[model samples]
Target: MAKIMALDYGLKRVGIAATDDLQIIASAIGTQPTAHIWEFLKTYLAQNQIEAVVLGDPKNLDGSATDATAPTEAFANEFRKRYPEIELHRMNEVFTSRIARQTMVSGGMKKKQRQQKGMVDQISATIILQDFLSRRSNGLF
Candidate 1:
């Protein structure tokens, strides 16, 4: 079975996560600098069977576009055009960063370790994928 991948795209980096082939577990993979995301994906996709991609969609409290919204959407569009064979999905990402931080704290990560931006990004991607998996399993997606 193919896996489902999730990405949390930030201006500086893109966090990556993926499900097991059984689509039952989501794990944080790593991160890539924004400039190297395409290169990273090219290699990753070639090495893995990814059935779909879940993209973090940023939105304001009122559902207005956040500064990152357009960029995320643009990236999603480009990804769709570049890899038309794979399915793509967008998920509301409000408070994911905050949640990621809290997760680090709860996981007993040291302050300095939790402060690392890349760690939060990877956790955020994991959260995105886990949420997607939950909703899909519940037939809400």
Candidate 2:
């Protein structure tokens, strides 16, 4: 009944989300600065039984890797090195940010709140986790 976590990696901050032990719902955990992301994730995994990790893979509109991909990959590599016991998966995150922004707007967030980058990051992590959960539910991955 371990939970799965999703990470939306950025240079400055990383958004985190997790699913219930039943794997029925995704929830935004929080955003942490990338300065000690590995340490933070290790503590989180120790506290919560994390079975696997799903990472958002940035891509261009044409399905090519975005400029951010390099850093993201580096982060992923570091993550793997830090926690080799956990499984890892990747999901295309082409429009998660845009969709997160739209969702925030539709939810009536104020302009100032919307301006906070962590809000979008958290939503993006949620989106990534939802996508991963859906695919798992469908038995497609």
What TM-scores do the predictions have?
A: 0.98, 0.95
Please state the error at residue 106 of candidate 1 in Å.
0.9
lDDT of 2: 0.92
Off by over 4 Å in 2: none
Q: How many times do residue backbones clash in model 2?
A: 0
TM-score of 2: 0.95
Best by lDDT: 1
Task: Note the residue pairs that clash in candidate 2.
Answer: none
RMSD to the native, candidate 1? 0.6
Tell me the tens digit of each residue's lDDT in model 1 across 1-141.
999999999999999999999999999999999999999999999999999999999999899999999999999999999999999999998999999999899989999998788998998999999999999999988
Q: Write the per-residue lDDT of candidate 2 for residues 15-44, one digit (tens) a residue.
A: 999999998899999899988787897789
**Consecutive 10-residue window with the lowest summed lDDT within model 1:** 114-123
Error of 1 at 28 (Å): 0.4
